[model samples]
Target: MKAFRQANHDLNSEPESAASILQSVKEQELQFEQLTRELEAERQSVANQLERCKLGSETAR
Candidate 1:
């Protein structure tokens, strides 16, 4: 990709700045992954609760 090539060129020319940029990108990626996992867990929990409520209502009738 062109983005990767630019990053590579930057890393070659400005090692410290490139390293800082890479670290920031990594931190952002980790945060995004954590948020994604949390959202999935919450979604699964809500789905399970909804199923339980549906089953409970059916049993009452």
Candidate 2:
């Protein structure tokens, strides 16, 4: 009877632990996606600035 009770308790805890881990993974994935978008936007801005500078120099020459 004691062994059965211990097994039942362990089984109950496993689902809760799995849910917590799943939630953490989801949050990290969301954060990673947001950072990726922001980095892309910054990269585009830098590229635009470089192009503008190149065009201005050609006009002066």
Candidate 3:
């Protein structure tokens, strides 16, 4: 396809474009990892709160 050839030509013409794309991908991956950690922390906090609530109800009874 003509579009594929044009894209290939563009990549071949600019080597730094590939490096720039690689850097962008690395940044996105780091951001994804950070978000995953934050989500896990939040989940743990919720679980702790639930366990405390259960303990409180049992003590009240």
Candidate 4:
């Protein structure tokens, strides 16, 4: 009887466990997206700075 009750409890908890994992994955995905956008913006800023430096050198020469 104890074994049977344990099995039933496990079966009931499976859905809740799955739901918790799903929520964690969704939060991670949102964080990943925000990081990607920030990285792209940083990359663009660096490229612009490099271009300015190159133009400055050409003008000085």
Identify the candidate with maximal lDDT. Answer: 3
Report the CA-based lDDT of candidate 2 relative to the real structure.
0.95
Best by TM-score: 3
Which ranges of candidate 3 are over 4 A from the true structure? 1-16
Clashes of each: 0, 0, 0, 0
- In model 4, the Cα lDDT at residue 51 comes to 100
Candidate-wise lDDT, in order: 0.95, 0.95, 0.96, 0.95
TM-score, model 2 to reference = 0.72
- Candidate 4's TM-score reads 0.72
- Model 4, poorest ten-residue lDDT window? 10-19
Better candidate by lDDT, 1 or 3: 3
- Taking the tens digit of each residue's C-alpha lDDT, what string does model 1 give over 1-61? 9999999998888566768999999999999999999999999999999999999999999
Model 4 lDDT vs. the true structure?
A: 0.95
Worst 10 residues of 2 by lDDT: 10-19
Over 1-61, each residue of candidate 2 has an lDDT whose tens digit, in order, gives 9999999998887666768999999999999999999999999999999999999999999
Assess every candidate by TM-score.
Answer: 0.72, 0.72, 0.73, 0.72
lDDT of 2 at 50: 100
**lDDT, residue 48, model 1:** 100
